[model samples]
Target chain A: MPEQLVFAMEVTLNGLMAGVLYALVALGFVLIYKASGIFNYAQGVMALFAAMTLVGIMNGQVPFAHLINAIFGTHVHEFGWSVPGFVAILLTLAVMVLLAWAVQRFVMRHLVGQEPIILFMATIGLAFFLEGVADLMWGSEIKTLDVGLPQGINLWIDETTFQIFDYGFFIDNLDIVATLIAALLVIALVAFSQYTKQGRAMRAVADDHQAALSVGISLNFIWVMVWSVAGFVALVAGIMWGTKSGVQFSLSLIALKALPVLMLGGFTSIPGAIVGGLIIGVGEKLFEFALGPALGGATENWFAYVLALIFLVFRPQGLFGEKIIERV
Target chain B: MLDAAQTTDVQAETLLEVNNIEVIYNHVILVLKGVSLTVPKGGITALLGGNGAGKTTTLKAVSNLLHSERGEVTKGSIRYRGESIHASDPADLVEKGVIQVMEGRHCFEHLTVEENLLTGAYTRKDGNAAIQQDLDLVYNYFPRLKERRRSQAGYTSGGEQQMVAMGRALMSRPETILLDEPSMGLAPQLVEEIFGIVKDLNEKEGVSFLLAEQNTNVALRFAHYGYILESGRVVMDGPAAELRENPDVKEFYLGMSDEGRKSFRDVRSYRRRKRWL
Candidate 1:
């Protein structure tokens, strides 16, 4: 009984950490969707692109080196000099910002006032374009990223929990750092939306675009700002995922993991993303650990999605999503 | 000596002018056919009409929000404070002290009432002191807003939402406010309260108003001048008192007929034949 209790506690902790990562990715979707009414299927690819750009810049890899070599029949992959990690991150941010502005200017600007489904489909196309661009620019190669994020077990937590039970708690310093950063990010976002003038305009835009415009808030400016912010968030999420595994194409698929988090929380609520991420993270982990063997193992794959499905049937608005009151 | 009312009328200062504007939507539909109106400085000019009578479109054209709906003022001009603003963006219009409070009480539902009011001051480069003072001023008029200031706008009652909408407009410190349907979907008491505040703002702050309203009785009571629109044309224009007493206005708009009781079918047929336009 004691061993089972300790195992449950460890699983819960791990699930919560995983959920924070999901929430981080989900946040990009929330920001873009709320501002422009675009589902932004490209959010995951944005993160992957951001990670690839960071890695390529840090390693001094030549942009479109593969394409350049293919066309000219020359082998050239290195820019001949590597940048420091912090400088590479800054450069990646700059690139993401440029991408955001370009996207708003070329795509979203023309797509304004389009139907929700139409905007959503446009983002799916955007996702493919972004992914292809990232691949073409960075080459389809996986790379290890070391930005000095903490690794190994948190001995202090392990030791502290050991006193409570015969077995100690197992957690990593990387997760602990991620958790702290996610909490800080949430605080910053809430404060931004609540206290700042631009933030209030953002909320207004999310509520009603016409109302926001009538109040002297520039809809395009707000959309671009939201996209830029989402880009930054993608960069953060990419960095976290890249540090955990390696920078690769699959990193973009993490966005799929975030969809369920959005379903549980509500796509429009910032805090909803956090809570939903936590619930899904813990729910999946605990389920897999407690019942995976009985259910032929690998239950973590679909547990979160199935739970979201049930929520959809019972409460489609989601836990924190706005109450949808249809009027004639 | 001229009557005090006549003395006041002699100071008719034009603030906003929409001169013979023709608006088209989706490049095919003509929404506003040669629509022309003027809002005088420091006076309430009411645009009264029923559903689909182009009242909202007229306001949107003045605010330059028509483009969002694929609607364009293909002819004529809209000038604010003696400057052509027919081509200006909605934000630029607001910056020029011409703000429109749209119909349907479009408050930022996710934000608190206070935050919605704050959004109104988005264009103002003025210091926080002035913004705060205006916020206090809004609270003073719609004290109910102060009571529910911390509450999310979506959760507020319709009456309170209407108050938030008007109070939000006041925060912009506009030379003129284009109000639409302030009485829509509100209880009679709440409608009176909202109009009472509108009168207070127009009287005390001297802010000009060009409000589009279907509630003819209420709008005429508060407005100094009124324009009755039909089928995208200004069918009638006169002082508020004259229109209120105008037999056609009484029979059709006010739902009262001096020719005694009439059947519903009789009223519908009269609507077809009494065509003031």
Candidate 2:
């Protein structure tokens, strides 16, 4: 293969990996959005919080220790004990589930029947609240998360491809792991929603709340269950992203990237989330590699949004969204 | 022909009883006022009315879908199998074998027809064998649904969507179904076809139905018992045969008087002759 061709292929491969991550974040949004019609702006922040909690648990950090010390002028940070990564993950999952329940019970329950835009704005408020709370609980400093996932380039892939040509496709083991995990998550979610009873209920709730209720599906229970699922998806996203760039405040900003993904894929579709993420991911990467230098570099920053905005004006229902047919 | 005020036949084996119910929407505007009806075990009962006459509201009240629209049963009680179900969750109703096919055929537009049927079975704890059997059974009744089982409900015709809704309710193994506007937005032939399937389901499956409809002629033709609703009140209740022959029902609802088609000039007499105030 030619050097430029190989390089482009490498960029495309990496873009696909990045797209998987974006889909992971968007899956959280889709879960909550499809089930409750709530555009959860706090999804990214929730990921940040989950990542921070995982790190804090693994390191045995005290909750709100920084705030306590700053206020009382006393130092009390670590608990002097380290928890196993696996144990910390389970504990963090429990916390996320609890947070989901609380959010649904307190914040969402009262806002039933509100307009979608209002609910969306409420999620923005939730994002700020969650960010502030997460910061207070585990301080805003960056923390490296080691969840035992493989790191660095896979030389085997590079060496084998290089044997056939010049410059073997360089690929990160983390990206491969993230890709495998993302595929598994999407498959599992698809199967769950398609084959399982609760999954069918979730889809039905997403379709029509009143109809689902008429068939004897609990609206409140479905809402809480979806939020919990969203939380779990957020945790998986956090783990992958945290491994790439540490757990920090910016971890939540990935939600911003995923919004365009949701728009391109349609907010209600899981497969669309994956496919849309891949498109944006590859498109942005290829654009940056081939055209970024000529266009002032860093075109990846706005490429996905511009693509989604243009896509929306032409096809508002999105790639897999139900056709928005209106009747008088 | 009897007067509209006449109440006839209260069966001892009634499965659902909506007794003197008054439904208020948004906590203020009253919709169903002192409306009472019953669904006998294994019988088709039609609640007939015109548009905005509270037929759908009455069904929603029975199915507990009222809260979603800010409507509630402010007066009287609804007893299902002799138990007060006013405060029960809608999901629990399905568990108890009561399902409502909503007005306008609220099929999950994004889902395949088969998937929509599966959703009706969500509350069922039966094994896959039975569920699959029921699925095939639904297919037997709604063969068009079987042909388009993989098609998205949104793309199907209105008649198909209505069949999907009914087929979905059947999958739950429901004892009673509250069918709202099964004839809406369909050809008269399709309406007759769907009602024929409903009749078959009732006869073979022993599923009781309380269908709310504005198609007075069709509803009364298929139902064993009929209630004529006007402005949220049940103005008349009688056996189907009696109501079909009632002069007032013919002139006012079925669009026919004793002299064939009643012209607009007889509208004042028809209004005066409506004995129920």
lDDT of each: 0.89, 0.89
lDDT of 1 at A275: 96
Which lDDT value does model 2 have at A19? 93
- Steric clash pairs (candidate 1): none
lDDT of 2 by residue, A144-249 (tens): 9998999998999999878877677888999999999999999999899888888888988887877788777787888888888899999999999999999989
> Model 1: runs farther than 4 Å from truth?
A69-75, A155-170, A325-328, B1-11, B256-263
Point to the candidate with the largest TM-score: 1
Could you tell me how far off, in angstroms, the CA of residue B157 lies in candidate 2 after the best superposition?
Answer: 1.8
The candidate scoring highest on DockQ is: 1
**lDDT measured at residue B110 in model 1 versus the true structure, 0 to 100:** 79
lDDT of 1 at A221: 89
Query: How well is each residue in B1-277 modelled by candidate 2, as lDDT tens digits?
Result: 1221133345439899999999998889999989998888888899987888899999889888888778889999999989999988888888999999998999988789999998888888878899999999999998899999999888888899999999999988999999999999899999999988988887789888998888888888788889999988999988887888998888888878767987876866767775566
